[model samples]
Target: MNASELQDIIAWMIDGARSAPTPPQMMAECSERLVRAGLPIWRVGVFVRTLHPEIYGRSFFWTHGGRVETGTVDHKILDSPEFAVSPLAPVFRQGVEVRARFDDPASARFPIVEDLRAEGATDYVAVPLINTDGFVNASTWTTRQPGGFTEEQLSAIRSIAVPLARYIEIVTLRRTASLLLDTYVGNRAGEKILGGQIRRGHADTMDAAIWLSDLRGFTALSDRLPAETVVEILNLYFDCQVSAIRANGGEVLKFMGDGLLAVFPVDDYVGDEAEVCSRVLEAARESRAGVKALQFPNGDDVERFRFGVALHLGRVLYGNIGGGDRLDFTCIGPAVNLAARLEKIASRLGRTVVASERFAGICDGGWSDLGEFPVAGFSRAARVYGLHDEISAAAN
Candidate 1:
């Protein structure tokens, strides 16, 4: 391998890596450059363990003439037998390199080595990408050439490991940030924040079918049940509501204790309000069925769970709001306030789902006008409506 070629790879890692945007692209470029540098390697892989609740890590695999491919491992993969027996275990656990010369009788015995040997690979090496924090990531290089990688080729490969680790850390950190943002905040809000909407007072009015839901009697339940039980029930409750909201194209913006706030935006300026109403209505029905079907156990019996949902159609100020140095990226306006009040009205009327007259009017049918009632905030009596069957059953 030419010394200048190795230098080119290191130069890109130190400077031009940002252009790659993602790890797979970095893997592709680095592997292709390694080949260009005259290393007799046919396969390259970089595995980065990520900080995430569900995902164990990600894999970037590059072949000599093929484009880079990517995949993810679940947390369970760490405990699997395949991972236990693989050379990556030592490389990742102890930050050491493992070499296998398929042509030699004394090489390491691992399932991956035998598989590579089957593919005509004569040499296999697993190297650790040690981060500055001392966390170890793993990578592999395999060669199908008859004589395999020489001492010079292995040395050149080792030279790039540090720089490659730096690039992988940057890329992986950005990804984990994006993932966590999308998890804690809704996807729409996450994108806006990442796109530089962090400043306070930055807001946009959006027309949406607003959704506010609350667990009925949650305060009393929390008073009696254990703290962990309260949390467990709330998670069970929100999981159903949040999943329904997201599945129906709504973004859950806030979890206000026992209540949740979400919105189905009318993205198209000329979009029909009726469509958003329909989607929110469907989500409402799904959420109702979900909680009623929940059978959470106490000690000897299932704990009863009932909830309320209020849907309204209106515009809200959606963005950052807080004092200096602290901000909350959320939605607040007349619409949300009205939704909150209607949720209370649902509880008063012993109903599972109710809507503002505006939301109910836009829907095709199935609404029963609950008549005018003086809500807490507004001066005038607001007209509320309930789904025909939901009102008939009273509360579930």
Candidate 2:
């Protein structure tokens, strides 16, 4: 609190708050300095509370030092009023610093003291780190001691808050930039899809409905067009298909060029084959409409889409499937196989949509009989139906 000490503290804050190449590293440095400066505690956790970027809107665990119990800690702090909308939230939102000690019972406006008493927090201090944009990127802290932190200690921590904020801003920008470049490029797109995979046999027993559809003759179209044109056309086609699938409460698990694999779980979000079938059918209809509207580069018309759809409901494990080096998030079961087979049958039968007896029975009787057909990889002839009149009527 002396003049020279104050000058030194101001200088440190200025350096910390100045723009840096790496915000994450700055955070680490701040923690180490605070711990080394005779703070009662050595470990710290940084919690980011913000609504910017939309993706990070949820209040959850951000980061922590080696010794802090971060992810394992409960999330009740987000609603405790003391931490959530308190001086901490406002200060951080305005890019200001807030330093507080939890040991003081007199500081009733803050609940960390009571929280510690309830959850066995013996001692703690916190400083909200706000970036220039006014969003609180991280809350720095020290905790777990015999006595509570004092005002002098809190002020010392507060003095470093601005730089911590600046550090967080830089780190977030770097991470975001890297992801943007990675996802927006060609080869990197393939890599990320492969990265989020699980073992081949992992997803096998959840209540799920497999929906598979593919545009017929897409290979021939690709062959006829330039590579760049093919890429443009495919992007346009998928934008529609993916949007429709998502809107109908389905997850587009994988896109196999012209084919798409999606799933609807009755237990999870939307249930029942009839409802799921109706949704899948709606999505397919929209996709067909979307594709038919797409124009070719030559100013001549491209061919309309002819797609085959198959739906099956059963218990299936759903996750990323692959071996050691690669993975793809998709569903697996006899249901998925059967659905794919039905799609092939639809193609051969010259129909736009086909469903199994299980799916047909569950659908609105708009489905008339197409009779049984012997299909590959099945012991019995699978009864299938062409879903045309019912769906066409529904669309009208």
Candidate 3:
């Protein structure tokens, strides 16, 4: 590895590498480029600390013959014993490079070193890639070449470390912003905000299948349980609803106490009315089963939780709305309110799932007319329908 070769690699790190779309793809390409440039690399990885609620960081691993493996480290793993002995532990904590020669028994006594040895790796090196914010990210390079990597090969890899850090930092920052936005707000909303739709009145109207659901007796349940226990119950309840909704192409918008609001956006051109409406109904059924099966080891107040869902299909206004500096990205329309009222009616009728006339008409069979009622905010009585099987189960 000559100075000219190292310079060429650095030039690519600064220019050509950034052309890759994502960090994981960029890492895989970088590894391939290095291998083509005469580096005896086996397994290489890049790990960056990220700002996220459930994840501590993200990782991209590239092996000589394997596909690029992307993974995440959860916050819980930061305190795990496995992470304590990994080479990254020292590199990130001390901002120093760690090298272990597997051929030498006296090398660093990390479990990862032994694992690499078993996998035919003779050398392992973990280097710190410090971001502009002074936060330390990490990268690891391993070689299965006989007697490990030569000093020139190691230095050549290190020569590009600075530019590599800069490139990685840029990509990581973009990813962090996306992860945080997607975590706090839903994906659809995050994309809107990212696309510069941050104004208070900028809105998008779409024909959508609206879903509104709530726990049957959440207030009484909260009153009876400890605050922490109540919150735990709420988490469990939402987990059931969120999973079902996302699985069925529904975007969860907001969680107001025990109530959840989500929508299945229909295609404006081709129109996915039947598809979207059926999916929303399927999601409601799945959510109901999930809540019913919620298990509490104590056999306490949460042994058999019950919930109700109201499905409606109509056009909704989705955008930012608030006063002054603070705003909320939400959906609002007569459709949403009608769904809310149907949810209350579902409670009164002892039905697990109810749907407005429009939603019921889009969906196939299995719905029974629950009759018309004088809805609060409307001029005329609104007709509602309930799932026939659920009504029979209630009677039983």
Candidate 4:
């Protein structure tokens, strides 16, 4: 292909990537670009082996039609080293200018090509896709046609390698983000119900105030609606709740089936007790206020939330805690338990905001006369107060 034609193809691939619905679409578009560039047999994709090595699982993989048929690679190549892997067994052993024309059966470079050749492929070219971190995602390529991929073809392919690498990175990040969220949400629920501590895999321990919230009348509401509708409503509700929690500088740890747990670390502890109290209160009120705006398909209003917000300055263990097969991201301590209990108290007392006296004592306004009461598991009557305003409230 001429310079202008190559440039046009590159531009097309970039534009297609921007609008592609899925990563595989981007790959397919790229393969098409290679074919138009005069390379035959366009098949491309990414592959990752399992971390356990023993599991030898394909943690992730995606492909576009280049040389191999859409799904013909089959089950065998999945776990076996027969297919290309990263760095240690990358297609481009050295730089991007790699060529294997002899179709050397003994050549270590294109091990998988031999398998494909045995299955009918005679010649092909594979270019390694490497991240900035030097992690090899996979190779992009063209299958055997006439004279195989030339040095000029490798150069042309190199020009667009970074963009293709970015595409792989996007897929990797999305998968990672999804897995992290699942583990985070799962662990939070586990801790809430199991009564133990679980720390996040990322951070060591965060010194922050935790918040627990539950929906009012969710049980009755679920009973009234079909199971699908119930799930839809709950998902919508949590979407808003999770959004609010993150918006207010807190991480949503878990959703307790009908409730949620969040925290504002004292590490980022922006203000004093009053400041923390105000922020936490504002987040709670916003969460509650947002619920009223949600509507279901049946036209019924969404359920409201009654938050039992307890902001205590204390140490809490935060991490994964579960069987070896499963891990959970959550916080555990007397403080988290106390916060949950406070939420229940708030519901019963008909108070919109209920907090421990320990938190109240350090802050400033918006408190009312709920007085002191003996908490269920605690030996003493913990001092508790109801919040009238989101901010400008004292804890004592």
Candidate 5:
């Protein structure tokens, strides 16, 4: 490619960087521009690290006349042999450019080069991209030109590497923040935080179906099981609750040891109270059934894991709360308190699912009254109800 064409591509990349396009879009555009500049490019790949619990980073791939393809690399992938021998690992770790001429016999050392050679690729070049924070990533390009890349084509690739890295870094950091927020907080809460509802006492009162649940005899189980076994059991227990709640359109807000708090916002109600209540009850029943199906890996004669779920419907203040520097985004109100109290009541009453009078009043299914019970932090006793045999049987 000529210098004028390269300059035009560079200008496009600089403008694209400022526009904040997504990683895949940026890669696809860059690849198309490079090809249009007469570089004989056949394939392009980009990889960047991110802050995530399960994912270590993302990879983008673009082929001539093909749409961009992306894949996530799990954190565990770094330990695998596949990453150890790949060109990306060396480029990232050594912070240098790696060039492989598949046409040369010496390039057979890397299996990826051999694979490219089989695919009619003659040259491969991987460049290390260093972010402002001093972290390293990699971008690679391959060509099928008969004699590989000319001096001008190689220079074009080198010149565009910096701006490409800058644009990718911007998109990557944004994605990393979003993924961390969504993973730690629920999606709805994450959106609120990102939308700038972050000040202390920044809150809104909204009606919701409050859910509180915890394992029965978890303290005893923890004492009896090994530390690792206890952790495994807790993870299994939480999986059940999270799956059920999320499947029913509820957001899990916080986890307090063996207990979890979630809610389904009712918004303006609009005569949908019964529908909301039914969803909460269905989630409660599904969670109960899910936990009951868990099998301990150790085959010890221990009692099966059991749970107590409490459902209540009322207004709650949902927002950031805490000291100046550190804050927790969660819900707090009488409804939340009552749901927690009912969870304990369910355990005491030997019922798997318990509902407060307010929730039962709106529920579409039958419920059996469990009489009034004095609950902590309340002025008067609350009437709690349990699912009727017919409803329970159908749920099971």
Candidate 6:
């Protein structure tokens, strides 16, 4: 390829990188452009490490046939033999490039080289992309040319490596931030924060079906069981509740020790009060059943697990709240307070699930009135209701 042609291709890549194109798009564009510039490129792969809890890194692949594919490498893969022996591994660890001539069978030290040779590839080049932070990523190219990549082709690949690394670093950082926010905070809250709601006093009021739940005898269990066992049981218990709530379209707001707070926004359902209330009730029922089915891994505890759930519908302040520089994105209001109070009442009344009068008024399912009770932090006593006998029995 001529210098002018290579310059044009590099310009195109810089434009794409500046515009924040996704990794896959960037890989495909660069590969296609190189092939069009008289390089015998058949496949291109770009891999970068990312900051994520569940994922170790990401890989983007582009083929000669215009197909793009992506794969996520788990943290466990770093210990695997395949990664240890791969060309990119040395590029990252040794801070050097790896060039293999697949046409020479004796040069095929890695298993991947043999596979590439079988696919009619003659040359493979893996370049180390060093970031400003001294981290090394890798971008590899494969060619089907009988003799291998020409000098000009290799030079072109080398020239684009730095800028490509810069682009991918930006993209990966953005993705890492997003994943961390979503993982630590609820999705709705994360979006709000990402959308410039960082001010400590920022808040929005919305109507929602509030849910509160806590495991029965959790305090006693923690005291009796080993600390590790208590943690295991807590995780298992929360898994049941969280899965059920999320499956029923509820966003878990916060986990407070043995208890949790969640909500199903009525506004999200177009103010469908009945539907929102029913979802919260259904989630509660499912959570109860799930807890009943859980069998502790160890035989040390044979007692059945139990919990109390309460549902209420009301308007809540949904946003940041706390002292300056330290805030929590969660719901707060009388509705949230009432849900917690009713959860305690559920335990006292020997009922697994309880619903506020406001929630029951909109729900279509049968509920048995549990009568009025004096609630803390409120002027008047609040009326609570429990699920019908048949439904409660079936849940048990």
**Best-fitting candidate, measured by TM-score?**
1
Where does candidate 2 have its weakest 10-residue lDDT segment?
54-63
TM-scores of all candidate predictions against the true structure: 0.92, 0.52, 0.89, 0.52, 0.92, 0.90
Instruction: Estimate, for each residue in 1-396, the C-alpha lDDT of model 1 and write its tens digit.
Output: 889989977988988476677667878877877887788889998899988888898888898889998899999987999989888999988899999888777675687877888788999989999888899999999999888888988998899888988887777777887888888778889999999999999999989989999998888888888999899999999988998999889998889999999989997753578877888888989998999988677678777689999989999999999999988889998889999999988888888899898888888659888889898778888998987776444544
Ranking by lDDT: 1, 3, 5, 6, 2, 4
lDDT of 2 by residue, 57-90 (tens): 2232222345323332244554655557364565
Question: By TM-score, how accurate is candidate 6?
Answer: 0.90
Best-performing candidate as measured by lDDT: 1
Model 4 agreement with the true structure over 177-267: per-residue lDDT tens digits: 4454445564334434344333335324556667877776688777778988888878887876677766666777777788887887664
Off by over 4 Å in 4: 1-206, 268-273, 295-312, 389-396
lDDT of 6 by residue, 1-396 (tens): 767777876786666554425667767777777677787889899888888888888888898987789998899988999988888888988879999987676566788998888889899999998888888889899999879998888988899897788777777777777887777777788888989999987999999999999888888888877999999899999999998888888898898989999989987544488887888888888888899898664455467788888889999999999997899889899889888899988887767888899899899778888789999999999998887853443335
Q: Which candidate would rank higher by TM-score, 1 or 4?
A: 1
- Model 6: lDDT of residue 308: 84
Q: Cα lDDT of model 5 overall?
A: 0.85
Native-referenced Cα lDDT, model 3: 0.85
lDDT of 1 at 12: 85
Residue 5 local lDDT, model 3: 62
RMSD to true structure for each model, in Å? 2.3, 13.8, 2.7, 14.3, 3.0, 2.8
Which lDDT values do the candidates have, in the order given? Answer: 0.87, 0.61, 0.85, 0.60, 0.85, 0.84
